[model samples]
Target: MNLYLNLPSYGTIPVVNSKNQTPNSNVLTQITSTTSPFITKANGNITIRQSFWQPVPNVIRYTYKYLGNNQFQRLHTDPHSNLITNSNFPDTVFSNSVTYSGRLIGLILESPHEEEYHSILTSMIPIAPAQSQNATGGVIDREIEKLLEIFSLQQVAIPKTFQTDEIIHIVILNPIPYQTSLFHIHQRALKGTYCTLRNNVWKCIWNIPNVRSDFHSVLNRFSSNDILINCCTSQLQPILHTWLQNLPHTSAPHLLKGHHPSTLKMKGRWYQTIN
Candidate 1:
């Protein structure tokens, strides 16, 4: 998985230790003295160069935390290994680097197969408030505003203290496709799901067993004009429904329209209404 965080402004961000102290030039010495190998910094605007993969045990849990309001807030926890084959499998190697000019940002990598975690802490970085601007908008600003609008329409809560300048855009590539094993099972249990044309749009519905069962079939039928509004369960319904309603509409290729048999069962039956 790849994670990208875009910060609005650029300046020098410091790297500090768990005690919030700046390490001497001998960072390796500091790491050797620590009990656990947790990274101290992974600034989104800076490039970090550190190898996170090395010869180690297979089963390990990696946690990432960021300093917020003088406290470390947990951001992500990844417990994975080659032994597991699910979509959330951890990356084998990781590296992170950021440039001062806000370009050439590298990946933040962590692996249990390695001996230590290296990070740069941003808690000590002094960020200056952005200068006032006119009502005229920039492309990125407009996009952020649009996202805020969509979140509002969907009734998604916004942080009370959130400010436009403080907004950090994080885009995760290939997020775990499903929420849980049970949700995956529900998708697989669907049956009698078919797509049909209605008013120049494609509509689909899937019938699934009300009870849990291992029996399932692969679902490969779909079309570019097909919209999958109704074929999701309560777990996925809100997200899919809201995106379809608010985001730009597009027609997917027929080849990409097929459903994964494992995704068929959700909230009893699945409905897809295309527009």
Candidate 2:
């Protein structure tokens, strides 16, 4: 009896003895007399069957079917239950396997194998470069300015003394009721050390020790508030100043009025007022 293992579109291979010769009488007898329900089809189709005479134990069988010219489909079957389990390939592998043959051919394994396959394939994927923090912060600052403009909020000029490496104090005058949103935006943009609400105003202290070398000259020329004011329209400045004076305790020692620049000198160098 001649036996053949056929691979679709790849032709067939004749089943022979261990020595690459024709099957002897003993091998033929074993093949014929065996009660095992072996493969019944001679075509490329895989037909798995059970047999008591088989030596191998607990071995799950997998069938690779050629769908067309080069495309193929895989089927996995459990050994003990003989039921077909998951048949679909992983997302990454199936996507890349379109143009490349033999990529996912022999990758079909039993249960608990998906994780291992994903781990191996993850290492093969290319990694993208990360964005610089300064660039990200700059974008966030612009967003805050846009939000302020949308809400008709005043843009204050940052004090020159507060631009240094030391702890810098900022005063937000007539802070809108949406103080939380502003606080979150500032935190995200500057990553400030600390911020708080006092007398319905927003006061924050930012301690930036490691200033970027590229921004050193720019920082010396303009404070953070100055940059923010430059981004705003000229029409909003006077309205913002008027709102500051109307705030509670506008004449208080800690509170700096927007109209007067002389009162600001009384505060220490770290203290900076924003209207």
The per-prediction CA RMSD against the true structure, in angstroms, equals: 25.3, 34.5
lDDT of each: 0.21, 0.23
Clashes found in each candidate (C-alpha, N, C closer than 3 A): 23, 2
Would you estimate the TM-scores of all the predictions? 0.17, 0.17
What overall lDDT, based on C-alpha atoms, would model 2 receive against the true structure? 0.23
Backbone clashes in candidate 2 total: 2
lDDT of 2 at 20: 48
The runs of at least 3 residues in candidate 2 whose Cα sits more than 4 Å from the true structure, single-residue gaps closed, are 17-19, 35-275
Tens digits of per-residue lDDT, candidate 2, 1-275, equal 55443323223445443344433444334344433333343353222222211111111122333343323344343244433232121112111112222211111011111111111211211111111223311232223223223212224332322211222111111111112112111122212221111111111100111211211222222222222121111222343334323433322222122221112232221112233
Give me candidate 2's TM-score against the actual structure.
0.17
